[model samples]
Target: MKQINTLLESNYQSHPAFNFGPNSWAVSTERLAAFNEVYAAAQQLSPTLDADSRASIRQDLEHALNDIFTAFEAQSTDVYEARFLFELKNACVRLMGEELAWYAGQPRSRFVNLTNKRTRQDTVRLQRDRHFFGRLPEAAAAELRNLAESALGPCRANAAVGRLRREDLSVNSGRTVHALRNVLNREFKSLGVLDAVSAYTGRKTRVTGLALELSVPQATWWKNAIAGLERPPRTLYAHVDETIACPKSIVYLSDVTEQNGPTSCYPGAYEAMQLNPLQEIIGRIVGTVGSQADSPLKEYYAKQYHQSVNSENFRRHFMRLPKCLRFNSHIGWDVLPGSELENELAASEIKMTGPAGTFIAFDGARLLHRGGLMQEGERVALQVIFSDSTFTERAVNKLKRML
Candidate 1:
């Protein structure tokens, strides 16, 4: 009990972003008291209970915890409070054990409850952590690996940028390729991947694009490429693809290690970075000034107000700015190196690295992610984007009709 209270206090003190002004503090205090009273009662009743009494007490405790969870869920405007509640609930689950088993069984409405054990676990993880990982069947992975190696052989020889579009494959319409695509599509559909994506974006979604990528040592190439540019490629830094969400799945065709520059992202940032009106305004202004002509004025602005200009909060909000206003032709906004945001993101970073056949899915639009900074060895991967139908499929259909 003492440890729980200490943890609660420590968490509250450390996370300043959760502080939503005076009323929030009051609400937090009330919730804390309520949690303590209920938790203390459970602790007291744990020992010396007969089977019947234990069952009754367990039912009561479950209802109490669910009521608290429901209350926090209802306060959607106070995300910090919800985060706090999530933490406390985790603690309670750990301490109480089987008394709270029912809570663990209840999946969130946003995720499909698949019957397959592996897919079910992955779906639950994706719902909770905004990412999930698995592997393709070994035979399929081997075939894909061979195809990738063959396709990139020329680019590797010249040390050129390594990317192979789906259309560029020599056997793009061959049986092997079709079989592999069918396997992937079937696996993802069985896992309810599209349904999960639609739940996140609040619209229907489908697989929109696919490509093969290779990452090799490019230190000299990158230096020469960025020599006269205002900024390096945005992909070199952590960023989101758009204000609207687009999730991605990547299948590693080669072993990826830290030196191989596997994709990395800040977990939970997808949900945490949601902005209010004031944050959006500040972010847009800072982003606009930073993207202006690379002159003394731009340098001056960066130097004079770099703290706010490069802050993680402002930068995240800036990345969320509407596409029209931002005029960002690239995939996403870059978080400057050594910025406050980078430091925070680094603390929680999850690198997507594993043996060949490893597959991972994550939200690209909302999560701050970056990759392709390889230092040694080569990495071959298949990247696929699954996005809202409104963004890709419908437009394609409209074009077909016009043609």
Candidate 2:
């Protein structure tokens, strides 16, 4: 615990923008005023303004954003910090209230069984200490990055079908696609992802559901500040990839940088959840806590939703279910943000960032994680899921005799 605290404190300075528990980066009044200027300018950017004048304002806004960070290094601090801190505290207090209210509404029995004992400590131990990080040999990393980039051209072309915040790809060209597949498969084995899953489940495992995801720059927050001219961007809430019942997953960062957005996760939190009965309830609501029958793909990838080529128009390919049923199908944040549980989980958060070729192998079904918000540059990655070969048979044996 002392070591973790030390790391968090050192990182707080290195990552001024990062919200590291109560040790947030200090901001000064001068910096706050600069941000105010930018916000005011952004509000006034009208269609009536000449293109050159509008461009100038845009530059001013960019400069102001930089100034805000610069001021953080300066020693002076005052009411600007106090006011902002108050607002931050107030928001959390309100969220805590909401969490309490939610708990009150639940059945009393839900809280009665709470205990002091830890549950699944071993499972939690496996995920603690940032167990998901490693680097590939330079040559191997370079080859994979180049192959992933080759598919980007085709990926962008398909975006017109409708681009999502996360790009999914299907390079139709046989040669390029084949090469990409070969590299990914080779790396998957080299990285010991298959072996790890096999050990976890006590059966041989195979990789499936390989995907390439790309994130590009966009002013997604524009609609949030403006009225109804356009809708706010869709938020990609945190989730686990358990739909395919994969015991584990591996993500390869083909291209990355500090500004390109990194993946964020809550280490040890998955195991912490084992102690909470409410977690099981939340998982059921989010479609992760159920039995095999609850899963659409009994054998995994039973329908197009489970296995489909990536494209802008991919949603159109899924078999339509009733609107009500769709709610249960979404694998999104298991718990509501700003809730009590969310606050408890935040302390364990770790943002994974690296150059191209860094990969994270994890028990995806057990982890609570989310994609990072891209600030500048693009982020590209490949994801692969693995399941034990005997998973289907084991699940079948667990089911009651139909007769």
Candidate 3:
């Protein structure tokens, strides 16, 4: 692993835009190389395995993709991660073809529990309570499912649709997501989450992006076999929006049963940094796509709006934190710290699981969170990321026709 201090001393002048200081802001070469070794072993798996055995192996590959995403979200650091994800995804397609690969990639259907370190005895009872799904009003779940289906159908026709997997979706896509936007807004307002969001960011926030996620089921054999591999869970990482001052919201659109994928987040992680020093060091870091104005998509948008566009815009508009909070010798902002944060994380962490209308509003730049791997049935949710007026205004104007 390249230490941030060494990286700063060597490359800081040449790559000023390089995010240094925060552990979450820098990539660990050691970790990346380790995952590469695992991928190599995965590539050599036997082809004669049964259906269930194949699914188990593919689940490990899925974690590999998630780890890559956690490493770097900036365009500059994306080539390797992108290549890694493609090869893993292709490995799945090669193993079981596209349809099953897609199924295995869904949130809840994972045959393994790779969220945290555990012994064989630790995960012996990874089953969902049947009653959990029944807790949600069936009518509401049905309504949301209809909305999700309708919302997803048109998006499938989009040029970018293939990029979306069961656990992820592209939010900025316009027309295809309009109805979902309306439905989600109404539901979130009803739940009082938008009010909490406004309070959090101290701004009249608007949804800047929307995504519909689905988590599906897996067979017992698949789960047991994969769990037997005993790979440690991916390290937790947060998605931070440097460009936006507002938080994000995700509303469950289906019964997020225990077996289905739920969101795992570290509560008070933001506040913890207010006191601890060790809490600020020693974790892999990455920037979020929203913060990259120089990115091709953002540049295209800037050109369409007849505005000056460059990577500098990203720094000027988003990265200019107050001097004390900027990446420096003592502290950094928007980072997910290392092991020191784990105990507090254990005490404060929240795993969100609920009925269709369940919702959570959080500071995207402050909180650390990850989408959970599912153990069973479909878990679907709609994510809406809110932001400051400037970014929201751009999104509004750009998505206006579709709305």
Candidate 4:
């Protein structure tokens, strides 16, 4: 175990994609030798140990294996690593059997309670609903509305969707908007929204302010046409931004209504998607498929699935997705709508509609959500993505300084 740890420590690099990093070719070469040595040693030592000692050792090994499994779960793996890890995991499963299953079945720890009263209350509601809505302070809201109007007013006149780059802002207005963004960031942090996001993700949080998004009535023409033809358009379906936890916020710069294509989400869907056993199994399958190269079905699988859909074996595993997850298929990740699944969760969907001051914060990765299906009036909003990655944090900080 010490040698194995040393090997992994020397080879591994912290990365969002590959657990062992892109340059560590040694992992593929050395993995089999390490695994075989460990397996042989465990077999030889088992008969000499007492039942209690054996149980303790088994538990420790399971923990170690689960740690490796979880790390691999969060990232992509090459074919060699995937095949070896899969085989090793199966070998451990055979040896540990029901005990391993029982251990892995334990629930994760609950979130720590926040200290501030308002923050605590908001956190509680966010945990329950997987989303929270509030109004920005009137002064701040007014400033934000003014900024959006100045930045996006011309965009509304165009038939196509449009965006105004930060570089395009007048010097004085850019400084004003930048100051306001900083203020809003601090306010969100103080309100405990950032803290709740961190808790949900189990990592430090960073906010990236996106370009103002302007959606006009013309943007929904194709969607309306599809509906008129009795087909469900992609915009009407709910999909996740990621399969993992990623919280985000939206500030309405213009009044948003049901007809204006307000963002919609299903409360409690965040936890449901994460905890579903079927979803977990499918996630593993997708990971395995993604690792392989030159497979006949690779292209088809890649085309059919996105971050939300859990499996690469789409035709087989898709129908087996939990009822809560069926709505994702309708979002066109699977290229077709699952009407039955959509109907099952339709009653619980909440459309975020409010005046220009409305602020909506949600776990976008796990929640079934969709936006920008405007029907009548033009819609303008500012979106902020909250992530737990150091890369995004650094990039945002650099952008801030430049602005």
Candidate 5:
């Protein structure tokens, strides 16, 4: 990992359009090498792929590295910028989803988990308990399955449909996913994590804040991904960190495109909780996004909007996001020495991203997050989470299971 200070503070300049600071980002070199290998392999495997498929794949990988190079300039200098490692994270997510799916005999599209506790469907269904785990039947599964079957080349068709049909596994007691995993490996002549994806990969790092997992396995991640957005009736919600009797956890999952909008993240802004007060002081360090037009709608005008920039009040209701999306950072603001606010809530109406397979683990206690919407096209992920991972006491993570 290259240090941010050396490259950023040294020889760099900020282009007005992309707002990242002089030294606010960095990415793991290992991640870069992995993508290179995957890119080459993809081209070799599908040299004859259609224009749309080739274009989508090229755009996706191009952004994966381009965003990393851009963010690395700042990540080298700031510890805070380190928290928003979407570049490295999304690289890993894409590899895990696509590469791993191939290793497990499932097609990229067939290997998804949108039923986690984070979906709009779950909030509509999970009344008593918010533990988002296992399988469920719905229109999404049926619709996605049809898409997957049609997407298969002549040789891969039957294999893809078999994987999609497994949604019939019930979610009741002793749901014995192990048996299903074995069957998938046999049918596909592949590895067995069709069950592992449904397993929880992490748990809350702290005890006092929100008690939830960091990265859940498989289909679960997809479920959590979807639940992070806002739609219908509810524009935004207050943090029930305290005073709530039974507050539910949120997560997201992905399909290829806009039909399901995975939460959009404010690039390099994941550590917004480390921010200082809204006084004139912050304007000295970094800037804000959108209408500097000076109305009450300015980015961090909490008093005016009753929330921070991370709040849905500022969410730029997005639809039809390009497959290769890019972000501009806000400048003239400062992240302080210590957390100063009273209600250090997670960001709301914010966005997050991942490719096909990997997961981004977040400290929900330190984030103001939301999944946002399930638009009308293919989405890029699946989101699911373990119970609430926020810590009111705020989980003091000594170490997470996977690091």
Candidate 6:
């Protein structure tokens, strides 16, 4: 908080006409006044903005925008910081969008269940921290600064808010959350983590990461620090085929303990899903010792058939590449440079295991993962949301309501 005050104070000093509009150029006075209003508004909108980063962005925008205004007074409408701030703001908006979806996806009445919402919401939130947080591209800065217009909604005020305060949206079903996803995805692509998740999961998508990603940081301080994100992460949400559109999904990370279980994958099984047949299977290793189906058939199967009849369903598994892929963990935060970054990807897909805090980035389409049932203690995981569609109010209603 002190930092933002200090930066704003310093920025004011840079603008000679900030306080004493007593008689400087019209542009200088106008820009300084406008900046001050925004600076003050941010303080009111988010008290936590007093941190060092808020200060940096505030000062950067103040100076950058003012400088652009000065040299191009006639074109004062063109603002530089507008682009950068918008990108950052858009990230926040995405966070809010997923949160809103979490609540809306539930039945209007069931949506009232805070615990249920939180679980699903927490799952998506985890994914945002694992993948999208802290990773920003330089392009957004240019786009917001030059491409954006002054009418752009204030990151803090978010004109959609009108005069309604943050408290106004606190309830289970309120206008506050309903509109958040629209503003977020429409503004920042990356903030929509749920949208990304939906693109990955073909079933009824329940993108956990997108849940409250934008607003959680504001409500909880520890989150922003954990995500290692000062600004918003980029939008990597993608899609597969039409039959299998990634819906919403829960994202999380965990370690291997016999009890905690592990992220399960069917090694090299994607082909079966494509084939969708009745014969093959991937994960299940034919039950040899037990039932009539196996026992009575085992004799006939062994005597009459050299090979066992495997269902295509069993064949549906994630590919395990020779080196890059390993069981349990597909990618590691330490060794992994990025997707296909292990260059020797021609090999089959495998899970790369790691310790706590190890981020596993993967191609969701190719990899099939299941949250294992723990045997010992509770499992710890960092989950994310993946979605393909924009989180509309209608979709949000379907989420919590369906299952």
RMSD of each: 15.6, 22.3, 21.7, 14.5, 21.7, 28.0
Error of 5 at 93 (Å): 39
Model 2: lowest-lDDT 10 consecutive positions: 316-325
C-alpha lDDT of residue 33 in model 1: 45
- TM of each candidate vs. truth: 0.49, 0.46, 0.43, 0.53, 0.21, 0.23
Deviation of model 5 at 320, angstroms:
40
Give the Cα error of residue 272 in candidate 6, in Å.
Answer: 5.2
> Measured by C-alpha RMSD in angstroms, how accurate is candidate 1?
15.6
How many clashes in each candidate?
0, 0, 5, 0, 93, 84
Candidate 4 RMSD to the correct structure: 14.5
Put down candidate 1 lDDT per residue, 1-403, tens digits, no spaces: 0222222223323333222233221124344345445545644554545557656765665565556556645653444334434543444443355323322232234443345666556656666777777776777778777756665665465455433322332233344444545556766676576666555544565565566666677533222121223554333545555333457887788888988868877667545544422222223234333333543234433422123223333333322322211221121233333434435555677788888988778776545576666789877777777755564666899899999
Candidate 3, residues 171-225, lDDT tens digits: the string is: 4455546666665566544444444444343344456578775444431111111
lDDT of 3 at 267: 49
- lDDT of candidate model 5 versus the reference: 0.29
Residue 302's lDDT in candidate 4? 60
lDDT (Cα, 0-100) at 353 in candidate 1 = 84
Model 2: residues with Cα > 4 Å off, grouped in runs: 1-131, 158-162, 165-178, 219-236, 275-342, 389-403
Query: lDDT values of the candidates?
Result: 0.51, 0.44, 0.42, 0.51, 0.29, 0.29
**Residues 1-403, candidate 2, lDDT per residue (tens digit)?**
1232223223323322222223234455555556454444444443346656655655554465455434433422443333322332333233323332322221222211113122123223333532456566778777866866767876665554555434343433356546756776676556654444444433455654566666655524111221221332232344544332354443555566657767766666545433222122223232221113543222232322321211112122111211111221122222233334445445566767777777666666466566645677767676666544454665787784542
TM-score of predicted structure 2: 0.46
| Candidate 2 colliding pairs | none
Return the top candidate by TM-score. 4
Give residue 158's lDDT in candidate 5 (0 to 100): 29
| TM-score for candidate 6 | 0.23
lDDT-best of 2 and 6:
2
